[model samples]
Target: MRLAKYLSHCGVCSRRQASRLIEAAEVTVNGHPANHIDHVTEADHILVSGQLVEGPAPKQLYMYHKPVGIDCKLRPDDPSSLSHYLPPGERVYPIGRLDKDSHGLLLLTNDGELCNRLIHPKHHQEKEYRVVVDRPFDAQFCDRMSAGVPVDGVITQACRVEPVAADTFTIVLRQGLNRQIRKMARYCGYRVVDLYRVRIANLKLDPQVLPAGHFQPIAMTELKLEEEEK
Candidate 1:
């Protein structure tokens, strides 16, 4: 595999970050600084910043109940980064992001391929959210949002929306755009006061069991991604 890909498989860093590390001479293969496009094999000795690089780790997945204030992006200087809540020494990253202001079920995994599959727009994975807008809205508002509203210069995909109350509703979307629910509501003259994801594909967030700021190991079988193509 290419050195960057190998590094990503090893749970060291992302492929892009691996390239930056290689450019900075932080990685060595067989005692020589690694080239950006170098291929790696079992026989090659690799070191990343004096730490030996080993074979890829077994894949791991977790269901985390993300809190509103936590940032999804991992940054060394950010104390509230998602990394801080994860188990020490596990290099898993979130499959998709929930903006800092929104919170709910977020998946973290070490399997890069699975991450790509879950987040890719072509997959059409269902994501359900419970939302509360600042003011009461009528059936027309729900109809407008369900039909598809313009957000970020593109019409959002038709989605299922059910009103639970004048100010609250549930929606299930097949596409994930940045702050999509908030932007969509804004376009329809409503402001989202609260947004919480309740489900992703077959995985559902049970607040009583896994409350905010807590996480638990989840089996890949629960996701049922392998059955999608069958």
Candidate 2:
């Protein structure tokens, strides 16, 4: 794997952070300053900031029910950051982001490859959400949202939108644009009152079992990503 990917797989930091470390000359491979393009094998020795970096550790995944106000970014000094809620001694990072204003299922994992796979736009990973609008909307609203809505000068991909109530609907999206659901609703002349993610791929959030602000370890088998087409 590339040097950055190797560092990420070792749970040292994210691939992007790893790149910065390499650029700052904090990483070394076989006693030489590491290059970003360098690849590693079992025979190579690697170190970060003078600490030997062993091969990747066992991967771990967690299903966290992120609260509405908690920031997804890992900020040790920030009490409201996701780092405050993570398990002690584990260096896992959130797979994708759920904005602080919205809350629901969020996956945290130490497996860098899996994280990249799930969040990459080409994967078309399905994410489902339950949204409540400020005012009642009709079938036309759903049709407009399902067909597509322009966001930031780009048209969003077709998605599944189903109205559950006069002012509430469920939507499934393959794209993960920034605050996408909210933007779509606003474009259709409806303001979102509340938004909650319900599912990501095969993983579903059961509020009763894993209530808000709680999390639990999830097995790799539970994801079943192999069944998904690339």
Query: In TM-score terms, which candidate is top?
Result: 2
RMSD of candidate 2 to the truth, in angstroms, is: 2.5
lDDT of 1 by residue, 32-146 (tens): 9999889998679999989998778888889999999999988757998887888677878888889899999999888766776787777888999999999999999999999
- Flag regions of model 2 displaced more than 4 Å: 13-34, 41-52, 226-230
lDDT of 2 by residue, 1-230 (tens): 88898888887766877898899999999999999999997579998889888788889999999989999988878989999999777878898899899999999888877887788787888899999999999999999999999998899999999999989999999998999999999999989989999999999999999999998998998996634573
Q: For model 1, where is the 10-residue window of minimal lDDT?
A: 221-230
Q: Per-model C-alpha lDDT, please?
A: 0.88, 0.90
Q: How close is candidate 2 to the true structure, as a TM-score?
A: 0.88
RMSD, every candidate, angstroms: 2.9, 2.5
TM-score for candidate 1, please give it: 0.86
lDDT at position 30, candidate 1: 99
